[model samples]
Target: MSFAKEVKNELTQMQTEDCCTLACSYGLLLFSRAFSVSEISLLTEHSGVASLYCDAVALLSGYVADLQETPGGYSQVSVRDRQQRINIFEKLGLPVQSPRKQINLANLQNECCFGAFLRGAFLACGTVTDPTKDYHLEFSIPSAGLCEQFIKLFDEFDLSPRTTRRNGVSVVYFKNSTDIEDILAHMGASDTYMEFIGAKVIKDIRNQVNRKCNFENANAKRAVASAGAQRDAILYIQEKRGLDSLPKQLRELAQVRLDNPELSTAALLPLLSESLTKSGLHHRMKKIEQFAEELKNRSENEN
Candidate 1:
C-alpha cells in the first residue's frame, strides 16, 4: 500500500468517543470533498477510509451513507438524500449556503478535535510520497478559501507548508522531512513517522559519504597534476642549465624531486636530508621552474 493509505489506515484504527471531535472530522471530510445541501459524495480506493467516513457521519448525525464497491478496487460512500446531507451539515455546524466554503474553526474546540479534523481531511483528499523517493505531503483542496484556512490551521499547529496549483486544485504541501514527519506524528501515525526518520538518516549518511569521497579524489588528482608539472620544470632546468649551475639548495631539492618523481611535494619533504615544511618545498620547486623559464627566454632571444 502507498504511504498515504498506510497513514489513513492507522488513523482509522484510532478510537474517538467525543461527539464534537467526530463531528469536526466529518465536517472536514464532507466540506473538503464534493459536498452540497442536495448531495454529498466521497470516492476512495481504500475500504478502510470509506468505512471510516461512513462511521464518522453515522456516529455524528445518525445518518447511514450508501456504500458501493465498484470495479478497479474503488469504494464509493455517498449521502444523496437531501435531509441526510442537511443533517450532516447542521450537526457539524456548517451552513448549507455559505458565501465562501471555509472550515469553521468553532467546531474544533480542542486539540483532539483539531487532529481528528485533519485526519478526516487527509482521508478525504491527501497524499504523501514515499519517504525513500521524496519528501512531500499535501492536501488537495477544492477552493482558494479552503486552502487559506488549511494554511492557517497548519500555522496554528506550528507546521509550515507551501502552496501551489495543479489542474485547478489548490495544493497545500510540505517538502521538508521534518515537517512531514511532524504531521504524520501529529496525526498519530507513529510507525510511519519512524519509518520516515529511518529513511532520512540513511539518505543523509549516503550523501555525506559520497561528498567525502569526491573531496578526497579531487585532492589526489590535484596532487598528481602538480607533481607532473614540477617534474617537467626540473627536467628542463637540468638539460638546459645543467644541474651544477643551480644554487646548492635548488640543486638538492631538484635532485630529491627527480629521485621521487611519483611523490607529491609534501611526501618528498621527509625524504630530504634537510628538513623543510611543505610550503618550503613548494617554494624551492617554484624557483626551479623560474630558472627553466629563464633558459627558455634566452633560447628565444638567440633564435
Candidate 2:
C-alpha cells in the first residue's frame, strides 16, 4: 500500500475517547469531498478511511451512511438524506447555513482532540508522498476558509505548512521532513513516522557518500594533471639546457621528477635527499617550471 494509505490505516485503528471521537468526525466531515447540507460525502481510494467515516457517522449521529464502491475503484461513503445531513451538522455542532465552512474549535475539546481532529482530516483529504522519493504531506480542502483554519491549527502544534490553490481546491502542504515527521507523530502513526525517518536517514547518508566520492575523485584528477605538467617541464629543461647544467637543488628535484613521474609533489618529498616541507618542495618545483618557460620563450624568439 502507499505510505499515505498506510498512515491512514494506522490512524483508523486508533481508539479515541468519546469527546475526541466527535472532534475526529468533525474533521473528517469538514474536510471531505462534500460536507454541506446538499451533500455529505467522502470519496477516497482507501477502504479503511471509508469504513472509519461510516463508523464515525454511526457513532456520533446514530445514522448509518452508505458505503459504495465506484466503477473507478474508489470507496465513497455518503449521507444523501437532507435530514441526515442536518442531523450530522447538529451533532457535530456545526452551523447549518454558514457563510463559509470553517473549523469549529469548540469541537476539539482538549489538546489531544486537536491531534485526533488532524488525524481525521488526513484520512479524509490528506496524502503523503513516499518518503523514499520525497517528503511531502498535504491536505486538499475544498473551502478556502477551512484551509486557513487548518493552517492556524497546525501553528498551534508548532507545525508550519504552506498553502496553494490547485484546481479550485485549497492545499495546505508540508515539504520539510521535520514537519512531516511531526504531523505523522501527532496523528499517532508511530510506525509510519519511524519508517519515514529511516528513509530520510538512508537518503542523507547516500548523498553524503556521493559528495565525498566526488571530492576525492576531483582531488585525484588534479593531482594527476599537476604531476603531468611537472614531468613535461622537467623533460623540456633536460632537452634544452641538460639536467647537469641546473643548480644542485633544481637538478636533484628534476631527477626525482624524471624517476618518480607517477608520484605527486607531496609523495616525492619523502624520496628527496634533503628534508623539505610541502611548501618548500612546491617553491623549488615552481622555479624549475619558470626556467623551462624562460627557455621556451628564448627558443620561440630565436625561431
Best by lDDT: 2
In model 2, the runs with Cα more than 4 Å from the true position are: none
TM per model? 0.87, 0.94
List the candidate 1 regions with Cα displacement exceeding 4 Å: 17-24, 70-73
| lDDT of the candidates, in the order given | 0.79, 0.88
Error of 2 at 196 (Å): 1.6
lDDT of 1 by residue, 1-303 (tens): 888777877877777757445744664465445777756777888788888778766865687888999887888888767787778778767888851376777677776677677777787888899988999999888667777777888876798789999999889899989998888877767888888899899999999999999999999999999888888888888888788999999898889888997887899888878989889888988988888888989999999
Q: In model 1, state the lDDT of residue 209.
A: 100
Error of 2 at 23 (Å): 1.7
Candidate achieving the largest TM-score: 2
RMSD of 2: 1.7
Per-residue accuracy of model 2 over 174-288 as CA lDDT, tens digit each: 8999999999998889999999999999999999999999999999999999999998998998888898878999899999988997888899999889999999999999999
Q: CA shift at 11, candidate 1, in angstroms?
A: 2.5
